[model samples]
Target chain A: MSSDRIAAAFARAASERRAALVAYLTAYDGGFEHSLSCLLAAIDAGADVIELGVPFSDPSADGPTICAAMVRAREHGATLTHVLSLLAQLRAQRDTPVVLFGYANPLLRRGATRFADDARAAGADGVLVVDLPPESAAILREPVRAAGLHWIGLVAPTTSAARCELVARGASGFLYAITRAGTTGTALAEADSDEDAALRRQLALVRAATRLPVVAGFGVRTPEHVARLAPHAEGVVVGSALVEAALAGPSVLGASVRALREATAR
Target chain B: MLRTPVDHRDDDAPGSFGRFGGRYVAETLMPVVLELEAGWNAAWADPDFRSDVARMLACWAGRPSALSPAPRLAQALGTAARVWLKREDLNHTGSHKINNCVGQVLLAQRLGKRRIIAETGAGQHGVATATVCAKLGLPCVVYMGAVDVARQQLNVLRMQMLGATVVPVEAGSATLKDAINEALRDWVAHPHDTHYVIGSVMGPHPYPTMVRELQRIIGAEVRHQLHAEVGKAPDALVACVGGGSNAMGLFAEFVADATVALFGVEAAGCGLHDRHAATMARGSEGVYHGMRSRVLQDDDGQLLEAHSISAGLDYPGVGPEHAWLHECGRARYLAVDDAAALAAALQLARSEGILPALESAHAFAALPEVLATLGFDRGRGEGRDVVVNLSGRGDKDMPTFAAQLLARPETP
Candidate 1:
């Protein structure tokens, strides 16, 4: 995938005011069958992208909800290969872009090149190895490029411009900007003045630092947040909100995504 | 009085101690880790916060345990060097480990974290963590190496008595590393409400830096004590280097003090020549538990299993800062064999009426080197004063010591 194509995809989505909902579900969140059903169900619920969580015993940064889900997934015998197969099944049924989210251990355990090749072949468009920040991209970048897969970067509220520049220089695909200073699966009460201003400033800084499309995430549970963050970012990636919606039931997910989509469209 | 660089360390906010520490974890975790960095940085700047922590240290754990001058102990070794020992051993839990445990648990409470998970080796740290958890009314779980659970049975019982769940980890040599892995797994699963109170100055990013900062009180007190008594700083600062928390704490204030040489002693087990774990003496660079540092590994890059008579020193990797220090020549690492360390433990018991933990004995054993290098004859007063950190009391090791002493045919 060319960088231009990724940028164009973000531009078109942004201009439509259609907030893209990125649904995150660990393959085997329940079991292989239930996970596949959930993946297809998420797409039917208006998920623009599917973030496939590969189960690893260790997730250095994830909070309790996601970590418990991952541990359950692993206990149910889910592996990277299993997740890839699930993703392939999703691709066969739909055309949604899939990004694999995981820590560095599993990827390192499998040689980077081989892991990238396997991921691309399994129908993944991008991979977010959670731990590979700007200072530590040497282990992943080249192989990801070689395998024709995008290496997505995550920028936090605390990332300084210097660090962001370094990460953006090497990043491909859309940049993921965290909304808060905490872990995944939880949202803070609306961003305070300091936090909101920092988020806006970081979004703007990240935009200037990289050519890639930037998507803001973390604690984005409502349509108001989607609308609020839309104009400032290339897109808004909703993980916990969508997962929470799915947990509330498929109807709730569809309703939430539709509401977000309508809000972003404005 | 010697001028040190703790003042210089103030310039690096978020993380950095004169090219020593910085955030090094991956992007996914950066937000949370950075938040912790900022919180801790701010905490350090607040005098009220420091005084509150200090109050806890003094009243709860009984601080200023004792800084007795060991002239007899020093003279017998022929260094004529005045050795003032800081009795961290008298702390509530009988080790310096409680100093960090109390500090970190307080931080967790401040952050509103309800559960605490930690890893332990000799179980001193586990006992410390458990004791704090019980005191604070927080849920605590400690992961212990299966091997350690067997060896330190009393500590295991103590942790249970303190209402902490002890999980025996059986993977990867079934030792401290395995326990660390299990604790990390638990943390990842409960990050929102749980804090992994790392016992030592190791782990990824904020942990190594944060834990060391908490342990820095050891140095801060030493600084004030040294100035009040000796009219000048000691010539050399020495401590055993396991995951290096104790040494780092004792040496933090003295790092940039050009006159005071910092020496870290690693356990050589039988000897450096023996198939032993000696990261400072014979290990290579490799990444384990998140950062690249001196690791005991084989040619193919497989981590060579480390061995030490002291369970705490059996870890294969040293802290990254220790690696950087070794590289920068700011600190020197010496190795002590098991016999030497054991002998030191016994000597301290007989002479000073203080039994030193085998792990702490490594620092005591390195005293001969201090004598030889500083041009101090055992009979003369020509050398500088040496401060050896009595890291932990030998209470936990009484069973091991008694058994070993009884089994020795050469013992009277």
Candidate 2:
């Protein structure tokens, strides 16, 4: 099962006494062929899980870097179906667990159930729609898990403990603890500040509420950001930094994810 | 002190417009928005807050703007309809947008936020937001699409003169949709000290519901004024819809009144097929700007750029409540092309000496199509009463109006 794959990835990282490195890259960001090469490179460089960001025209929750990447990806003829096809091709080559990430409109345009089943058939292990909170997720949640794909939940510092429990109810792959209360590429606040102290409290709250492994993300830029997260959560997701690297080329993205991978050591 | 803490145990905060409106934002915004929802609920429920908003509307926004009888314009259209104009254009900010701006600005104060941000398409809302912020001594930032900033230069200058910084967003066709995306980005980054005063009855829950409540003063006044003038319910209520705030403001009072007919006219830039903002005619049901409304989107649900000579009406989606009303057949919606709206503006200016905002001209253009149906022709005496919401004045649209009409002295 997909949940077992995600759990095994976490357990494997734990056996090595290190937090897992989940690298993110937009499918078709540079171009379909370029993105595929970068994805294969990141996986080869020891990324425990891969988050394949499906390009969208209006990515409201993202910062400028990811937003621009999505625009470039769309210009390259990206779509949910096209990204799923990319996923299928990647699956033919590798066994790394992959999560499909995007907003709700594109997934909803394809019909929630249809998209979930298609994503699963494409060998997707999990799904995370940024705007589909637990309140508005009813239409997509059941179909997502029933397709044998894990349901990943995002918990922010602003989310109260009870809401964290509500999110963890159906969550499977992992709980994403937002390290900051901003979009995807804002700089994470310095430690010892009120925001850093608040994030620590949120991690404690999420830890108390869910059995699902918590992976802190949002604004995570460097190995230092991953190292900061390693002590508090089970994993770290490097998104914009890796995306910026992929735009530079495949080798730069490989070196970037590898550096993040090394920072996961306990 | 925060008026409302993020203490929600669930996602059951108010602001659902019958399955169309809900908080569909990211988790980072989810809790803070819930706090906003709670703050709004408490503020509105208090008699003090209600009175404060009412006082501001009357004193600052020029509430109870006269319902002028436009018999000359009505007769020129060759309809028997006795047309009355809800003169929202005469308000302090030259539009009905001030109603929402003042309300949201006050809400921000009560919530203890220090900065104000807004998105504007035509700059009317931006001007209104800047006006209110200036009065209240809050720093204001307005996001406008680069396309709009170029066209609506007068209003842009007005906002800058009012001490608000105007930002021209260059992303995504560089229009209202892009401006809104930029505003949402700004909000998420500075959630603790910022309040996004959404200018229309669009976006996610709470915003749809909140904006509707703020603008409802228009319809409420129309009811009392029409009652005193003609002493009966109107036969039909007409307004132009961009994001549909002005129309919803006028229609909210009459949705429960079975005797009144509601008509919402959308912009057809040239024609629906070639270029237009007629979401009701061409859009499919999907989510945009936080609400599930009739949206102009491609098959993949990517938003399509809307076109209208009037920048205010060039939006890709309608309000969620308007969507529900269309779903249940409570209102009739149709398209009014740019040429027709241009003619309507010329007719009103010649007949009644009033140049309406191009957005408001769309409502006037629909008067002919709707009045004949209500038996408001020249000879008919019964069921001839109609009210058209002139949502704003034409001062800001003079450049576009002059260019479109082009010095043809004789009225079309």
Candidate 3:
């Protein structure tokens, strides 16, 4: 359950022309069993990684659908512990790495060190504390590393080269490059010259700053977006595009995994 | 006069009510919200302040707004409960919101502050603030939700006309709450020179208290007027609760009056039974902005998005003191749905020729229920006096009201 193992899985998936499908499901989005069904479906549909969102009181950077999903999850009595238990179930079934994606509250509420230990024990290989940046890395990095978990940091296009280099130095496993300034689940349309240039420069800066690989995410809807991002980073992360597929399909969870696999192949 | 809490005593700490009001902001802007809070706090304490406000009310804003008695409303409800509305609609700027904004802006001038910043929900406060800033020759920056700006184009134009800068926040839900977040971020970014005059009685400690104190002028005046007319205070008082500032302002004067019932009506967009914005009826103790108050939160304590026809009352949370009063059983919380509030708005306009602000109509809608609680037949002909704070005028809401009316020709 080390973070290194999780990064390696993604690295392999990228090299094989098979996307590392990251299926997103809030624990107890419906019932516990329904949540388990979604989890199982994602795995069966070829998702290499599953990102379980730990619902919180305030999720500042969330889209309507994801926000609604989080509401549904909380309504069904899901907590950080509940999410970990579900991840434990998945780990029992397969060796696929599970990533815990959430804001800092639940993690802080759960006690960062304790959360890291529990996440690793419950089959989680890495953690993405969305609000915490390199400046505040001490909040989670040491504990995560001690618990044999990867600390994945997102570098936005707006981030400066110095900050990007700092992120690279602090990052373990791989660096995540968030494509935009806003929240999740929006489509990638046009790019600003300054932003695109800054992202490329940041990637180069990250490469120079650390040995870890960098992955680009946010608005990677199609193969074109992937192709555009692939040459610049180690891999591409498609969350909203796959989420859209899940939402459109009869089996949202299964469709997400399949859409990602197909999109990466194309 | 009943012994108000020591902290609640007027002129105790210059701008403070108890431990509540003080300047809590970044060091740069520490002088601004503080200087303004202090100047206004001191000015309102001056006997001249009340007279100046009164003079403005009469000559400029057309004050002594009619105390319209809703007789038809009284007759239909089968009781003699008289509904006397303080016609804030008669004010030049339309709503009672200008009452606070004008006071603050005048005080801002006294403090040598040249700029004002504020956040608006439905653009009522934004327009009011912009108006005051324009009249006082002060620069104003009003943060508003992009969605609201699009919907409330007239108000946006009004603000622009008043020479206030409108920054449309495109973040989060693109609503009042997001507008507030953007405003706070702006304040944090430029705390040194700007005075952030909060629109409602929410935010941190001093804000909820200070705003209520400023707004108390409404209830204080109403209390004297009602006393002169009826020989005693009305049996019940009602006001709409967004962040509950209006209600808090009106209710504060009567909190110690055990016999005088106070009612705070929340916007139940659908119903309180449904997932609506009835924070007092449906919410629990939670902290947001600065104060620990009742907020519309889901099972995991996540703040739920609130829905209401009135943008001012569409907030997902109630003021901390309102929450505390509810807990102490000093005030009753009622839910007024969007349809009910709209109906009340139109009814007031048709009956009294007073087009009430959407938020104020929510208070009007709850009058029927409050009268019923006071042993009068609901919505009927009783002479039992009930004072409802008509917080604002409906001019700003005309476009929205017309649109809604056009969409629902069948539903009066």
The native-contact fractions of the candidates, in order shown, are 0.21, 0.81, 0.07
DockQ of each: 0.14, 0.77, 0.06
Supply the DockQ value of model 3.
0.06
TM-score of each candidate?
Answer: 0.68, 0.96, 0.62
Report the C-alpha lDDT of model 3 over A36-55, residue by residue, as the tens digit. Answer: 77777777887766677787
Clashing pairs in 1: A17-A264, A17-A265, A131-B26, B78-B378
Q: DockQ (C-alpha) of model 1? A: 0.14
Model 1: per-residue lDDT, tens digit, B285-318? 6555666567786542445567888888888888
Predicted complex 2: DockQ: 0.77
Error of 3 at A40 (Å): 25
Lowest-sum lDDT 10-residue window in model 2 chain A: A1-10
Residue range A121-150, candidate 2, lDDT tens digits: 999999998988888887888899888899
lDDT of 3 by residue, B40-129 (tens): 667768887767666765676666666666677566556777777776666666776776776666666666666789999878789889
Which docking class does model 3 fall in?
incorrect
lDDT of 2 by residue, B151-197 (tens): 99999999999999999999988999999999998998888899999
Using DockQ as the measure, the top candidate is 2
Best candidate (score: lDDT): 2
Give the number of the best model, judged by TM-score. 2
Q: Which ranges in model 3 have alpha carbons more than 4 Å from their true place?
A: A1-266, B1-59, B273-275, B378-383, B406-412
